[model samples]
Target chain A: MKGFKYLRNVTTLKMDSGKCINCSKCIEVCPHHVFALNGDKVTIINLDSCMECGACAKNCPAAALHVDSGVGCAAGLITEWLRDHRLLAKVECC
Target chain B: MPRISADLTFADRLGSWRVRWGIGRMNYIVPPGLYAVGRPNSDSPVLVTANYKKSYDSVRSVLAERDCWILVLETYGINVWCAAGKGTFGTEELIRRIGASELTKVVSHRQLVLPVLGAAGVAAHKVKKETGFNIRYAAIRAKDIPQYLDSGMRTAPAMREITFTTWERVVLIPMEFVEALKPTAIAAALLFFITAMLQDRNAGFLAVCGYVGAVAAGAAGTPLLLPWLPGRSFAFKGVLTGSIWSIIFYMLAGGSGWSRFMALAAFMILPAVSAFYALNFTGCTPFTSRSGVKKEMKVALPAMACALLAGIAIAITGMAI
Candidate 1:
């Protein structure tokens, strides 16, 4: 997190500002520090740092945060795609 | 809460080592229930954690001198972070564990200090509303627990933060290597047998070495030199390493006698194989996201397949000539 950064603008993380109650649960839970309290509402400050771990979204009481959270690794995604397309022998995601 | 010893014996250390090495890791679990960290009573603060032995050990070892209650949820030996993502360490499990343990009758406080990383599954408000135990995410690391409790249960920014230091990255490598062992062996054996039939025994041996080198460069080397590698996409960095390995092999293995086509094939195939393995290593990492991995595979996987196929074709043609 300090010295390394992943790809930019690829995360599907979104925040519903209107639904935010500024409880700061998202801020407290996020390991990446993706959220910030902007007055009475929470905002995605470090949007690119989001790893889509779903911590913030899951803990959000107001349901203001959303992200397509899963095993964000190439092997898992490849296995899923291949299975869906029937391209390879059924292999489980590790 | 039942009083239990917090001391980690030699056997626990050996067991943890075995688990880290992927031996009996899946079944290496502790019974999920409320246990004492030190001499804890009903007044002691409660800490929630997964039932993975490693996770339980990590929590208890940090609270050696302190008295606390640890609520371990049944996560089927998975660590807190992954188990949280899988929902085994979710709201339902927490609530069920609290109820099953009769935690309300044991503890006077309504708060349950959960690991910050576990927030992905447990909804604090829902847990509070349903079970009357207000979930408080204490800190990202268990080592910071004492300070967190001393600071009146308030988590400082640094405590909540996550950092993937070099040492942290290095520690995760062993499991990755262990997981990849079977696949690597099978691939190497296949390469050896196929190349022996296609060429000579010495050629088969050389081909096997080349393939193993590629795997090491991608699965092992790439992670060690991750920060310094030149590309955001792991596949690209792996390709660079693979190309370097191929060139080194060419010099060491005497590729000068081969046709230009054969040398080209070696460089292409080695790098592509390395790149594919490196890309797969994304699953072992902390930062790579679903969308990013998908985008990378879309471009890299096809390129790897094409390079591998073309390299084989060129190698065959050069041999015929």
Candidate 2:
């Protein structure tokens, strides 16, 4: 992770302050430390660092957050899409 | 608590069987619509997700104790980032789902919580314009959903980092080894045959060992030593390890009388092969970007090719003379 820097900003995460209960559930689930607490509310201080794993939205009780989290690897996605289209033989890499 | 349907069990069984047999992991497509989980109240928070079964299940399974509404969108059985890349998981889908589900009729609140990875697919501003529900991008993993809700929807820094731990690295080795085995076996067999024909039977066995060892060093050892390897690039790291292996093989296999040319050939070729296979690992790792992989391949490929060719040339000359 130190030497490798990702080119794709593949995270679909965004937060609405109006609905945020400031429960900080996003902080606990995320492996990347993408979010930080700003007083009683949550902040996406490092939005670009997200890998879109979808741990936060599923855990939020307030239902005040949204993200299109999923696998971010290009090769994995291409293989998945190809299988969906029936162009390539079925292969599960994950 | 709302009971999980029998259909879910059937689906889980099928998913696991498929995975075991190396079949494509089936993603169940949920229609882009809102549905209640555990008989939630109208005021319950709305959680958003792609229609991929794995993503849906991960969210639902984690939310078993809570009551909420799940807004699933058609991602064509693909996960969020990939679906987003293809535009299948986008603002348009979210808006359509919101309208079709009559979400306004179900919930009084205007906010929709979404997975962070879906940002590449869904445009928050467009979703707001087309549908009144404001998008809130949440944490990256499903396990943290409960904590997120309790924290008033706040995210901490730990929730965002992506880790590739030793166990994670170890789990990936099986598939890589399986994939590489066919080619490695073929290469080893060919080397064995050639060496046996040109030299002695013992030489043939040693050659086979060298080839197999190089493959292991490159494909398996390199990945396992990823964090500790000296060089930043995978290829360099692999070559470093392979060279050490080559030296060990040389001392054990009686290369002392060997000419400088042959010894040079051994050093050059074995490590290059190892490095090439190790460099291929960029596709497997989480940290590598497409651009970075391309950059590494551009420089590493030609050098590997040259070294391999030079080694072959030296070996042939040594045998001829």
Candidate 3:
């Protein structure tokens, strides 16, 4: 996660300090280390580093983190689109 | 409880190799329950992992001679990280597994050691609240599990960091290659026959081989040289890789005999082919995000389609000439 940088400004990661319980769950769960404790609440220190894995949001107790998390997989997207169009009979994804 | 050895048998190695190439990958599972690694007693540390045989095997192999209680959860054969992302390895399941396995009876301590990647699904606080078990998000890799346990269950910074080294990339290549092989063969056979019937058999054979090389460029080359490849977008990197392959193919198969149209077609078709496969690799990567891949596909997909179409159109023209 240190050197592998992806496209910039694409991730939908947002943090609400007002809603944050200062639980540090975001810091703990984030593999990319995107969140950091600023005083009490966590801040998105490296927004560009976010993979939007949603680990932080999923683990957050106070509902303070937000990100559109899903598999960043082209095959998964194609499968979903096919299913939406009813072209695929069964949906399989990772 | 099944007392499983920490050491893997020759059969385990063979199974691992088979799965790496996408054989029996879906059903590669161990039973979802409790197992003892190295004869773990009740007081030994409890480590949780998905029931995916690969995941289970990784943990056990790393443990070697170490004593630990392995709680294999039913993730339907998915590895820890992906299963965690899908919520199959979520807090609910962990709590359920603990209760059902009568884990407290098996382990005197209430501590559950989980792979750091599993943090995506399991909430430490929720598990503690429900099951009264303290969840320690341990090492991301099984290799680091021993050190983590040795360090009194505290995760070191290195243990938490995610790295996509060349070896890591190498191990993932087999499945991706195999996934593309069948479809590619079918498409290539059709194209090869058509081209042979239409113009020259030599051209057909060369073109099919070149196309397969392009696929290899995307699926195998891009990932192996990923860190050094140009562009952050995988599709772009793949195009570059394909371009390299196209050059190599052209030089090897004697491009002197090729018409200008054929030469042009190689660049266009090969790069486009590579770009599509490279784009598909987003799912296999450690750092790529859902949004980033979506954005990349939005821009790259149309371009690849156009390049492929144009290349085919001109190839037909070149062949007719």
Off by over 4 Å in 3: none
Residue A5 of model 1: what lDDT?
77
lDDT of residue B128 for candidate 1: 90
Per-residue lDDT tens digits for candidate 2, residues B236-320, read: 8779878978998899888897777778888998999889778777666755544444446667778988999999898878877
Comparing 1 and 3 on TM-score, the stronger one: 3
Report the lDDT tens digits of candidate 3 across residue range B1-321: 898998889999999999998899999999999998877787899999999999999999988878888999999999999998899988999999999999978888889988889988888889999989988888789999988888888888788888998898899999998889888999899989988998879868987999899999999999999989968999999999999999899899998778999899898999999999999998998899998998998899999999999999999898777
Docking class of 1: medium
Sorted by DockQ, highest first, which candidate order results?
A: 1, 3, 2
What lDDT tens digits, residue by residue, belong to model 2 across residues A1-94?
2433343454457777788888876765555566778876688886655545455665565777777644434345556667989999967654
Give each prediction's DockQ, rounded to 2 decimals. Answer: 0.80, 0.14, 0.78
User: Global lDDT of each model?
Assistant: 0.87, 0.71, 0.89
lDDT at B199, model 3: 82
Q: After superposition, how far is residue B4 of candidate 1 from its true place, in Å?
A: 2.7
